[model samples]
Target: MKTSRLVIGILSIVLAVIVLFQSCAVGIGNALQANEEVSGSAGLMVAVILLVAGIIGIVTRNGGKGPFVAGAFYALGGILGLTNAGSYGDLILWSVVCFLFAAVFIIGNLIKKKS
Candidate 1:
């Protein structure tokens, strides 16, 4: 269980980085093109939040709550992206990936608690 938490913590941090980079890329591209703001800022904010949560989870792996909290944030971000599909478009794919990762962590945490 400890090992699994460590692995999940690392992966969550990696995913957070990916999401943050992707959000920044999109925001920069929009700014360079002089396009009106869209969902980029929201996505960026969510990514930043996720990144922070991931770091916290990594730091508090033994606490058992960090991963679950981070996973909930991931799931919330994914759902937000999905619900705002008109603005997010292709980003929804990334959201789906987030959902999958969230499910893994949340379920793992739950099962660990049960055992």
Candidate 2:
């Protein structure tokens, strides 16, 4: 359990970085071209949420309510990203990953409790 959290934490942080970089690159491209095919700000916000979720995951390595908390953040970020993804295929991928992580964290905790 602790190991899972650690792994997810590191993974999420890496995802956050990827999202941030992509968001910035897209935003710059849109700015240069004067277009709005995809909302860069929305992507940036989702990245921030994922980053926080990752941090929470890392801090919750003690195995308390950390998974639930991090899961909430992940879900929130995922939903937001999905809603605003527009033409950004990468955003959808990121959102899906975050949502899946959220489910894993939350469900893992519940299963542990039941066992």
Candidate 3:
């Protein structure tokens, strides 16, 4: 596996954990003050995508399509979250991060294909 994939995998997991904890801290306690945090469901969805992508990166062979598909999922999930953010304004940063990761993975995949 490429070093980029490995680094992305670890960082994705770390990001997932951060998202999860933030969601839980705000959601579970029903202490959402001014809608400055992501909703529980949305956070869970994003976190799951990140976690799955991380796992795929760590375990899959170099040429497998897991990272490519994970990239697609990251883009899809991020876009959906951004579009449906509603009153949850704090979700924007995480959504943007997802897009960044998606871009990295997709661009890396394309570069590999060309080589």
Point to the candidate with the largest lDDT: 2
Give the TM-score (vs. native) of candidate 3: 0.80
Which 10-residue window in model 2 sums to the lowest lDDT?
33-42
Q: Global lDDT of each model?
A: 0.69, 0.86, 0.74
Question: What is the C-alpha lDDT profile of model 2 across 13-76, one tens digit per residue?
Answer: 8988989999998788778888776657778988999899999989986667889999999999
lDDT of 3 by residue, 2-114 (tens): 88778888898998898778666646644446554446667767778878877776665275687788788789768866875644555677789888888888888888888
Looking at model 2, residue 81 earns an lDDT score of 86
lDDT of 1: 0.69
lDDT of 1 at 45: 63
Task: Write the candidate numbers in order of decreasing lDDT.
Answer: 2, 3, 1
Q: In lDDT terms, how accurate is model 3?
A: 0.74
Query: Tens digits of per-residue lDDT for model 1 on 30-62?
Result: 788776755677567667756665666567667
Off by over 4 Å in 3: 29-38
Model 2: residues with Cα > 4 Å off, grouped in runs: none
lDDT: worst 10-residue window of model 3 = 29-38
Best by TM-score: 2
